[model samples]
Target: MRNTFLKASFMAAMASIGAGEAGAADYRKNPFTLAYDGAITQNEPGKVNIHPVTYKLNGLDIAANVYIPANYDPKQAYPTVVVAHPNGGVKEQVAGLYAQRLAEQGYITITADAAYQGASAGQPRSTDKPAYRIEDIHGMADFISQYAGVDRKRLGLLGICGGGGYSLAAAQTDKRFKSVATISMFNSGRVRRNGYNDSQLNSVQQRLQQASEARAQEAAGAAVLYSGDANLSDEQIAKLPFELYRQGYEYYWKTHAHPNSTFKYTTSSLLDLMRFDATDQIALIGQPLLMIAGSEADSLYMTEDAFAKASGAHDKELFIIEGATHIETYWVPKYVDAAIGKLSAFYGKTL
Candidate 1:
């Protein structure tokens, strides 16, 4: 009986995606639809302009978007920030939203699709290795620091979700970033290793063994095995135990669906991810730091843990959006506004 109900719910979700009933707004031309009040539809004269860019990173073609502030002049130096997307996200979603908003606030911003995901080039795709992810952040800094009108000394970083964790890791050694910030930071390593909030502590060894087998399969030139790839009905999504996963499905799979965005990664990637920790060398980040999270988010503990260990930063702050959940911080207007407001002030003062 329970199986029958779940099957019905899954079918309903798939039907909704097929029928294009994910949201009222059309997605084909406006996949950037979130609750952002004044989002730009096109690059009009005297408005923020988006530049589609591609650069080579470790032999892979990395795609990115550079948002230039209105009245941009290549001759004048400008402070720039690199926005990194969440684990399974592409550059056109939340990352781009924050980049656009920052540009509107008079700062140059760039958001890039990670090398192995989105429109970027990579093989055996969706490999979520930590080294590659951290390298992606470094690659962004390498390209954006040299961009026309950018003041290399005033470079900053804003990472969301899994990207936030990588930003913390990247900024630890990349002193080029004058300031670093994260929103709804997810300690990918901790979560992947022990499950969300350490709920899977007992399964750590078992998962490691599974990851090892996946790696062996890849070594034998067999088909790649992945994890976390699922197609669910709206009803199934609604019934998800965690608010983060539930709303995540709605945001990524429905309202903001993009051809490249996915929630899957090569199972072998966990071998490296399980060993990483965003707070490992956090104290080495001497630059000013800001961590933001929804007060009600299940992921709040990750931010708090990292914040508490970021003792090297002479100036650090942990700000919470009063009523937001994890996904709400991604698109909800009020929460986004509060985050951007704090970001503007923080960057304005530091950069």
Candidate 2:
């Protein structure tokens, strides 16, 4: 029965891909187009209003979007959630999708582009260090807690993909978040250090040396070296090894192509990413935790691993979206709805 369900879901998804081809072509001209279902094209008069915001974080201006719930009133305090975007994603993509959905559920939500990436201000852009990413989460907490209608004590957090991993790290020490949740969590540290599923274990030392050299070049004020910097043809992208990488390219490059969304990162960033582990201090997070992932996702292992190590969150729950892959959870309506449903229930109870 489960196998049959999986097959049906896969077929439906493929069918939708065929139907989306024309729409994808329409979006090809604009790189910053928000192509997801229920995207906020323009803020309605009385409906949810999306406010573009910027705040200082570690001396850099961080770009973010705050979604004000329908019929919002500043006089009444409201619960708020800070959303963290995926790697190579911006404030207007999946992160914005979830934030808008959460706002529809009556929570004021804020989604921010990571500092040094996606419309945010920083020098030597696309620097993907884990510490800076974690600090971005902390910075979001600081800014949103003081927003007009926010009740700081009623704060919750929801992170997707790479942001999920950083959110776990930030929540480990920052108790300002009363509740924590993640969707399709990507363990950036593990993947950077040992390849996806440890496939590149043999090349760890070589990669470390490469990263060290990249750092040395940066220190000497030479040109910055970037990893995963490639502009692949349609044929080349189609032939990528993993579904995560292949679908990721389709999502970021073809479907929801954003000019600021690139997979490249400063090569030296790996020096920090390789040594950091989201699960290293997982036991320190005492807030209620909800970690959601697709059951069929190759990245499910990371979510399971992190959840297993989350010993301090006695109220934790691992929810799996059946028959969905990692990237599918980012946009597929059924899978995303399942995730949002679970998230609403979790935050409704915990926040």
Least well predicted 10-residue stretch by lDDT in candidate 2? 23-32
Per residue, candidate 2 scores C-alpha lDDT tens digits across 1-351 of 323433553354344445546344223232334556677767777798788888999899888989999999998888999999999888878998899899999999998889888778786778999999999999999999889999898999998999999999999999999999999999999999999987899999999999999999999999999998677787998897788998898887767665567788999999999999999989999999999999889999999999999999999999999999999998899998999999999989998
TM-score of 1: 0.93
Error of 1 at 63 (Å): 0.5
The C-alpha local distance difference test score for the whole of candidate 2 amounts to: 0.87
Deviation in Å, model 1, residue 217 alpha carbon = 0.7
What RMSD does each model have against the real structure?
5.7, 8.5
Candidate 2 wrong stretches, greater than 4 Å: 1-33
Q: Which portions of model 1 miss their true places by more than 4 Å?
A: 1-16, 22-26, 31-38
Per-residue lDDT of model 1, residues 1-351, tens digit only: 323433553464455567645543234445343223355667777889888889999998888989999999999999999999999988878888899999988889988889778778787778999999999999999999889999998999999999999999999999999999999999999999989878899999999999999999999999899998898877898898788999899888776666567899999999999999999989999999999999899999999999999999989999999999998898888999999999999999999
- Candidate 2 — which pairs collide? none
Best by lDDT: 1
